[model samples]
Target: MSLQYFAGAACRALTARKDGPSLYEVCDPILRQPGSGGDPHLSKFYRTALGNPALRTLLRRAGLPELNDPARLNALRQALVLARDNPTPDWESVGGPIAELVDGITLQHPAPPRRTGAVAMPPAAEIDRVIRACGADLLGSYGRNGFIPTYAAFNLIGDPDIRGREVLMALQGLDARGYKNSTLMFNLARVFIARSPAAAVINPPWRGIAEPMWEPVQIRHRSAYYDAFFTEALLSYLETGLASSEQTGTARAAIAAMVDFCLETSREEVRGADGKSYHVVTALAPPPHPRFSRFFTQIKQDLGFGVYVPDCDTTACSFSAATQAGSNDPILDQPLVDFYAGYQVRAGGNEPRVTVPINDNIDYEGGVATWIDSMAGERPYGNDLDPTLNLDVLEVSFRNLTRWQILETEARLAFIRRIVGFQQRLVLSGAFADPRAHIYYLPELYCAYFGRCYHAFMALPPAARQAIDPGGAFELIRLRVLAYVEDELVGREMNPFDAALALIALGHLGGNEASFAPAVHCIVTAFGEGGRRHPYRAYEWNKMKTPTRILVGGPEVTSAFVLMGLALARRCR
Candidate 1:
C-alpha cells in the first residue's frame, strides 16, 4: 500500500519510453507473458503498488514540483526507468526521486469554467420523437428477463420529480394487457405506488398482485439482492400510500406478511466476533439437495453464510474449489452493506441493524487475485462486478426513499456522503484512463456518472458539496466525459442504447444543447418510422474495429435509455 510503489507502477504502466520497454515491462515481466506466473514479484505488483495513498503522502513530504510541471515529470520518468533496471536498488536512495515522480503523475484539477452557461433546452419535437420510439420499444420488449424491462418501465413512467404522461400510459397499457408475474413486475408496481399513490390505488396491476406477490419463489442468487431491496421498497411505499383508513388494514397485513416471509426464508445465522449469534439475510436460499449441500457448506465456512453465494455452474465450482475463498473480497461485502442500509431504512422497526463482519486481512493483493480469478471464469468474484452499475440501482432506491422522506435526514446525508466518496475514488483511480481496460464498460460508466453519482452529489447540502469537490474535480470530470463522448460516441456507429447514454451524460455535463442536436438526430433517424422493429444487439467491445452497430438487448433497452436521456435533457434545458 506504499504510495511510492503505486506511483512508480502507475507511471510505468502509463509511459512507454523511446529507448526501451516500459518501466512496468522491465519490473514485472509477467505482464508481457500474460499466461505465465514466472515471477512472484510480478504477480504482487498490480495489487500492492498501484493506487497506494502512501505514495501521495511521500510526494508531499519531498516538496516536489506540481504534477503539471513537464520538467519534473520527465525527470521522474527517467528515475523510474533506472529503478526498474536496478536489481538490488536501494529504495531509500531513490525515495526522493520517486516522490517527485508520484507528484508529477497525480491527476491535476482543471480550471473552473469561465461561463456556466444558461440551460439550453432540447427541441420539444425531437423529444417527442425519441419518447415515442422508446415507448414503442418498451411495448415490444415487455416480458423479457433481466432488469432492462424494469428499468425501461421506470424510466418511461418517469421519476417522481419528472412526469411523462405518454410513457406512463405505455406502461399502463402493458399492465392492462396482463404482464406476467415476475420480480420486476412487482418492483415496477412499487415504483408506481411511490410516484402516485392514487394512480397506484386505481391501477389494475397493483391491485391484481397486491396480496399473492408475497409468496416465496426461487430467484437466481445473483438477482436476489436487488429483488430483496425492491420488495422492501414496495412494502415501504405501501405503508405510506395506504395511510388512508379505507385500505390501511388490508395493505398493512399484506405488507407484514411479505416482510415476514422475506426474513424467514432469506435469513441465515452466523456467529460474530463477540461469540454471539446474529441473523443476516442471504441473497438467495440454496436448494435443499445433497449435491449442493457440500458447496453451501464451503461458502458458509469461508465468508459466513449470507455475504454471497458461492454456488455456480460446474466449471465455476471446479475453479472455486481450487482457488481461495472469494467471499472475503470487500467489493462483495460493500454491496451487501449497501442493500442492508437501504433495507434498514425502508423496514423501520425495532429490529436490530445487521453489521458486516470485518476481515482485517482483506487487502489489495487479495482483491486483485479475486478479480483475476473471477474474470478467468475460475471462481465467484464480486470485484469484477462494476460497483458503479450496482450502486446505480442502490442510488435509485436511496433517492426515492429520500424523496418520500422515509429516510431520516442524517441517514440520507450519510448515504450521500458515502456515494460521493465512492465516485471520487473511482474517478481518481484512473480506472477508465486506459481505453482497453474500460471499453466495454463505457456505457455503464456513463450511465452511473450522469444518472446516479452526479445527481447524488447535487442533492448534497452546500457545505457537504464543497467538502467533496473543493478543487473543481467536477469540472475536470466534465472535461474528461466530453472528450470520451466526442472520441468514442459521436460520428461512430454505436448502439442506440450506448448513444443514448452518451447523450444523457452530455446533457448532465451541461454541454451546449446544439452540440447534442446531431446525436439526437441520429437516434431519431435510426429509430425509423412506423412499426418496423429497431435492431437489437448485445454489448461487446471490438479492439480491432470500432462498433458502428448496436449489440445486446432489444429496442426496449435502447428506447428506455433514450427516454431517460430526453428526460435529463429536459431538466438541463
Candidate 2:
C-alpha cells in the first residue's frame, strides 16, 4: 500500500514481457549492496562451516566425516549435514562454521555443463544481478577523468583560433613535405565528401569570448558521443557521394584542393575522370611574434586556466539572435530576457555562452554559416544586429536554454540533411557508384549525428518526431553502433570496411516497411563484406594493446551514448 511499493509494482508491470524479465531485474542486484538487508531468509547464501576446525570436530563427533579442505566435494557434504539441524546455542561454534561452509561451497561449486542446443537463457533474477554489477562497474570507470593526451599539445598552441590556424598551417607544410596529422587528414577526407563547397577555408579555431572557456572545437577521438553522430554522418556521405552547391570558382577550387588532399592522404588514390591529382602548395609559417602575455593573463583571469603553449580553449562559433516572448514583451523574446537577467544581472555580470560542439574537422566556412543561421535572432554577444529590435523590452520571449537533447537532435538532423542533399544529388547524376565510399562515410556520419539526435530525442515525448526514414535510420544507426565495438577493438581508421553495421541498424532497428526501400540495395552493396574491400586490420589489431598502453585516464562520460544507441536498437527490435 505504500507509495514506494506501489511505484515499484507499477514499474514491473510496465516493463514485463513474455521473452524474459526486464532490464530492471538485472539492474537491481548491482544497485543494492551485499549485507544491506535485515531478513536472513531473504539474504544470499554462503558456505563457511566445513572448513572450520571447530565445526569439523563437531561434525566428526556427530558421525559426519571431517572434510577440512575447502575445495573438496566430500568436505562440503559434511558441513551441509551439520547445518541442516540448526544446532543449539551450546553448539554455536559447530553451527556457525557449518553454516558458513555450506554457503561457501554452494557458491564455489560450478553448475553442471549446459547442453549445446539453444542454451537456456539465464534466469531473469540472476541475469539482472550480473548485468547490474557490470553496469555499476562500467559507470564507475566512466566517471574517471580521461586525459586529453593531445590536448596538452593543443593547449601549448595558444588560443582556439590560433590552434585552428596552427593545424591548417601544419597541414599545408606537412603536405608539401608529404606528411599530415593522420587524424585531421582523415576527417578532412570525410568533410570533402559531406560538404562539397566551391571553396572552403579551414579557419583557425575560434575561441568564444566567454567563461568556463571550454574548447568547442571538433575532435577526432572516437567516444560514445562521437560514434553516435559523426560516424553516421560520415557513413551517409560515403553512401550518398558528396554534397554539391552553387559556388564553383574559388569555392570549388578550395573544395577541390581538399579533395586532392584527401586523395593524396589515402593509400588508394582517389582521382576524377581526368586521372589527374590536384596538388597545391600554399603554406604559411608561424610569425616570430612576441609572446602575448595579455592573452594568457586575461584568459586565466576570466577562465582560470593558464594558457599553455597551444590553447585548447576555443568555441566553434558565436551565436547571436533576437526574439520576443512573454505577455508584457516589447517585441523581444522573454525567455532570453529572463535567462540573461538572472545570469547577467542577478548572479553577476555573466551571460550564458552559446556553443556548438563538433568532433570532426569542420570546414571553418560551413561552421560560420551554421553559427550565423542558428543564432540569427538569439542575441548571443549583446550586439544587436537590428537596433530596432530590443531584447530587454520584447513581447515574445526568446528562451536561451542549453539542453543536451536539443543540441544532440539538431546536430543529427543537420547531418542527415547534409548527407541526403549530397547523396541524392550524386545518385541522380552519372558519377560511378562507389560502395567503398558509401561504407566508409555512412557509419561515421551517423555515429556523430545519432548521438546528437538521441541526446535530444530521449528528452522529448515518445511521439514528438520520427527518425529519418525510421526503418533505415534504425538499421543504419545500429550498424554504426557495431562499428564502435569494432573500432575499440582495433586501432586504425577503417570506415569503408565497417559500414555494413550502419545498414544493419537502419534495417533491423527501424522494424517496419516505413523504413524499407530499394535504396537499401545501395547499403547492402556498399558494405557487404565480400563486395567492397577496405583496410580494417590496422585498427582492429591495435584494439588489443591500445587500452592498456594508451595514456588515456579512462573512458569518457560520452561513452554512455554508444551504449544507449545499442540498447535502443536491441529494445526497438
Candidate achieving the largest TM-score: 1
Estimated TM-score for each candidate: 0.38, 0.24
lDDT of each: 0.34, 0.23
On residues 248-310, what C-alpha lDDT tens digit does candidate 1 reach at each position? Answer: 453344334334333444344543323444344343445541123354345333221222332
Residue 431, model 1: Cα distance from true site in angstroms: 3.6
lDDT of model 2 at residue 6?
A: 40
lDDT score for residue 218 of model 1: 12
Estimate, for each residue in 191-262, the C-alpha lDDT of model 2 and write its tens digit: 211121101111111111010112222111222112112223222222222222322132223323222222
Model 1 worst lDDT window (10 residues)? 541-550
Indicate which candidate wins on lDDT.
1
lDDT, candidate 2, equals 0.23
Backbone clash total for model 2 is 124
